[model samples]
Target: MFSMDDFYKSGEVEEDGWNLMSSGGRSNHGWRSQSSVCWVGATALCLGLLLLTVIMVAHNTSAINQWDSKYTDLIHVLTKGRDELRDERDQLKIQSSNLTQELEALRSQYNDVVDSRDKLQEDIKNLHRNRTDKSCKPGWLKFNNKCYFVSPCGTSKTWEGARKDCQQKGADLVIITTRDEMDFVKSSFAITWIGLSRHEHEDKWKWVDGTFLDGDGFWQDGEPNNSDGEEDCVELSRSATAWNDVHCNQKFSWVCED
Candidate 1:
């Protein structure tokens, strides 16, 4: 019926379709640009996170290495100290052993010294005991294991009579050989008869036991000068020298020894 008018409207609708195509092309280009910006931002964020992690790891590694070095040094120091202490302990043990040995040696020496002292003391005791074992007869004084009998007061005799009286007993007139004995005899008897006589020669003295007077009899100073030729017998003087020449018949107290 109206074919010509409808065909003209269809041509106008086709022109509007070109306009819609151009609007769609502009929308697509805007969306692609927004996606590209989002991707670039995400990539930059990841790269920053990686860089920070690397810095932290490097710092921690340096700190760990420092700690390890300190620990190693401490261990070395402790080990050295321990070794030194061990050495000192060993030295002390050695010293202790040496001291013990020295103490033992000293003890042995002390024991030896004690033994020597005991032996000496025993010997001395034995000597004194032997001397003490001797006893003097009645009415006699003892000196150096010898017995002496000093005549009592109011008793006097000639030298020959005294010697005979002593011979009746198992004793003789005391023959003094030491100064101590002479002193003892002098102390006991002021002037007494001894064993000295000049029976062989006028001036040569002899003992009653038949022994010659080799040395000078214990005479007083300048005594026995043969005051007279009759002075052949000898008597103890009051002087410490203990001898004086006297006549044979002179009577004086005499000494007897047993």
Candidate 2:
């Protein structure tokens, strides 16, 4: 509310009072102004430096984000590769298992074939050996590595008559000991007299060699049943490997031994 002129006059008086003091000289006043200017400049510079720091921090944050993205991409690629590799390994394991099974099956088949081949070869060798052997005379049957001769002498004779005929020819009526011998004698295609007969007893058979018919070969299903208790001597049939007990005087081919 003071007037301008009064304020101006009061300021002149205050300046005069300050001039009178040695401490409040003109140089000191100029220094105060300069210090204030310097403070203002320093404050502005600090504000600018703070702004620059903020910008640098933002740029660095952006770079870090980019690096993180790159790392994520690399991880994704590696994971995908790992998955593919696992799939391939699984496939290979399956194939290997299949191959192993196939190999075992093939090995079993091969073993069977080899065994069959060996058996066939053995049979062929035995046949060849039998064909070349001289001890088995021609027209004579061989069985169990032994030779048998069935006489072709056609006659229906008594048990004594058949025995005498075989002895004169250095052989006896067929004395079969096994199925093989029985089969061989029957294959001769001649109805011949054998050594089996019931002489003094009924339902009992004896051999012409005077030996009891113990453990000797009998016809299949058992023969010399002596049906009606009349037939007593056994003879081989020409049609099959069977025996029949007929009358001792019946006319039939006789069997000699050698």
Off by over 4 Å in 1: 1-132, 200-203
The collision pairs in model 2 are: 151-256, 171-257
Q: What would the per-residue lDDT of candidate 2 be over residues 148-247, giving only the tens digit for each residue?
A: 6655544356666877776876677777666666666776656777878787565567776777778545563556566677788788875767778877
Candidate 2, lDDT over the whole model: 0.75
User: Could you tell me how far off, in angstroms, the CA of residue 113 lies in candidate 2 after the best superposition?
Assistant: 53
Please give each candidate's TM-score: 0.48, 0.40
Q: Pick the candidate with the highest lDDT.
A: 1
The per-candidate count of clashes, in order, stands at: 0, 2
lDDT of 1 at 120: 97
The runs of at least 3 residues in candidate 2 whose Cα sits more than 4 Å from the true structure, single-residue gaps closed, are 1-147, 153-159, 215-217, 220-222
Give the alpha carbon lDDT tens digit for every residue of 83-121 in model 1: 999999999999999999999999999999999999999
